[model samples]
Target chain A: MITVSIEKKLRTYGGGQALKLAAEFLTGSVTKIYGPSGAGKTTLLKMLAGLVRPEKGKIVFNGETWLDTERNIDMPPQKRKIGFVFQDYALFPNMTVREHLQYATHDDAWIQRLLAVSNMTTFTSHKPAYLSGGQQQRLAILRALATKPQLMLMDEPFSALDTQIKIVLISELQHIFNELATTVLIVSHNLSELESFDGNVLYVGNQ
Target chain B: MDLSPIWLTLKLAAITTLLLLAIGLPLAWWLSRGRSGIKLVTEALITMPLVLPPSVLGFYLLLAFSPQNGLGKWLLHTFDVQLVFSFPGLVLASIVYSLPFMIGPVKSALQQLPVSLAQASYTLGKTEWQTFTCVLLPNIKPSLLTAIVLTFAHTLGEFGVVLMIGGSIPGVTRVASIAVYDAVEQMDYSSANNYSLLLFAITFFMVMAVFIFNKYHAKSPLE
Candidate 1:
């Protein structure tokens, strides 16, 4: 299970305000995060992934304290073993599709399996520049799964895919998440896109 | 054609370029990523050579390498080495004079990279060094190449700082630039013309090659 209670100061266009959030995620369940623009949905994901520091917070994952500001205990992102897919699909420009997976793991068989699941087998040597938006998004998802992370945080992970592809990939991803027994958190403002996810929703906004 | 000065100039540019890469990588990385008050002070010190008059920098360097100053005396007493009027002194002066050429390109390249790339690497369990070498270095190859070529070319053309610190000594401190000055002072136009032509040809070839390579292979993603 994962538990978080955090507060952070945010500067929005209108004015400055404080963001406070508290939540608990079961060990192997999917959670969808939905909110208006600038509601700190992305920041919440970043904070959970250890990419951002909250002003005062405690994040505990499976009884391990990832962050406890009062006690001054903070484990860096690398040791936390979490997977994150950025909204921009942050693929390394210099690395090819195969190289991206190889960077995360030495298991060639696992890489081959991931490529097959993503239907990217033929594009292994292609760099991100050559891939279409949907392809790049799939690559981002595959790369995040390359390590078989126990916790996955994805921000609009299916925003670029067509409806047909999104449905098929989401089904495949659900199977993969179940097999890995990984707890997943996905943020998306489009409700229909995440209809197949079968998860609880967390809303963030003016409140 | 006294080839000794040509060889010495090449040697100096090569060593200085290599040293600049060693020093510039970490310094540029720090400058690009760090958010601290001390970064401003360090950046100002590094950029001093860019705007300050070369002769003024040379004048201070000459004093420091005179064997009368603390650094010069310490070097002499510890290593039996004299910096002033020596080949090593020429390299030291060239490094200072051409520092901005190397650091500027590298810092810009690093800063332009999206922060997500580094964050992705970190979540993959790669250490900072691994991320820098495996991810950042490969993407910024063009900038590194430009930095190297510019620093070498700049060092090759340096005059005032080298003159003040190293002085003209045959096959020791006399580089191609200094040799050209000496030949012209003696009305030896033929020797001066030869040195000038050689420098022009080599420096032009190197710069052109890098530009061509970047155009064909290392074009930025924005392009």
Candidate 2:
């Protein structure tokens, strides 16, 4: 389980708005972070991933202190060991799909399994530029999973997929999460997108 | 035609370009990451060569590295090396003259890349240096090519700095640009034209290579 109480001042067009969030995410549980646009949803995920720092707060993951401002203990993103699916996918243009997975882990078995799970086996030799939107999204998810992170933070992971593909992929992801007992925190602006996710909802609003 | 000047120029340009690549990569990476007063000042100093007259830079470098000056005297006493009016001095001068060309395009491309790319690498447990070399640098090949070719071509065409610090020493300080000047002074129009034509052809091809690389690697609509 991870406990977080972070206060970060996000810059807005008008000025700065302090985003004060205090929450807990249980292990092996899926939590859908639902919010409006510019509601610091992505920032919250970034904070959890150690990609962004909170001005003041403590983030304790599985009883380990990932962040503690009072003690000045802030772990870097490289040590966070979390998988992040960025809004833009963030796939390297030069690397093929298989190479992307290889870069994250040396486990060839795990890489093959991830490619199979994401239905991206045939596109392993293709670079991101040659992949379709849905294919690219799957590659991003597969790349994130290649590391076998305990916590998976996805930012609108299904925004680029078709409905049929989304449903099938969601079922596959759910099966994999169950098998791995991975905790997931997905931020989505669309409410209906996560209807089939069947996870607890955390609606981030103005503090 | 005394081809020694052509060979000397190529040697100087190659050595300077290689050294600049080694220095500029780390310096540009540091400069591109964040903003600060120190970084701003350093960037301004690096950019000074672009606008400041080559003679101005050469004059100060000449003084600083001259055996008569304290720094140069210390160097001469300690290492028995003289920079002013030497081939090493020409290389030093060329590096200073072409620094902006090496750093500018690479820095801009590094800055323009999406921050998420590095973040993704980080979350994958890659170290900062690993991410920079394996991830960031590979993606910016077009810009890297431009920076490298421009630096080489600019170093090839450098004149004022080389002329000021490195006097016309045959097979040593005398490069193609200086050779062109020397030939023109002696009313050797044909030799001057040969040197000028070579430089023009080399620079043109280098620029064309940059254009072709950019065209091939241009990011298509990823969405």
Give the poorly placed runs of model 1, Cα more than 4 Å off. none
Model 2 docking grade:
medium
A1-207, model 1: which lDDT tens digit per residue?
999999987766245866799999999899999988887888888988888899999999999999999999889999989899999988999999999999999999999998987889999999998999999999999999999999999999999999988988999899989999999999998977898988888897775
Which predicted model would earn the best lDDT?
Answer: 1
TM-score of chain B of 2: 0.96
Q: Compose the digit string of candidate 1's lDDT tens values, residues B25-124.
A: 9889889995788988888888999999999999999888889898888999999989999988888888888988999999989999889999999999
| Candidate 1 steric clashes | 0
Clashing pairs in 2: none
**Of the candidates shown, which would achieve the greatest DockQ relative to the real structure?**
1
* Interface DockQ per candidate: 0.71, 0.67
Candidate 1's TM-score: 0.98
lDDT of each: 0.91, 0.90
TM-score of each: 0.98, 0.97
lDDT of 2 by residue, B23-84 (tens): 99989999999899999999999999999998999899899888989988999999999998
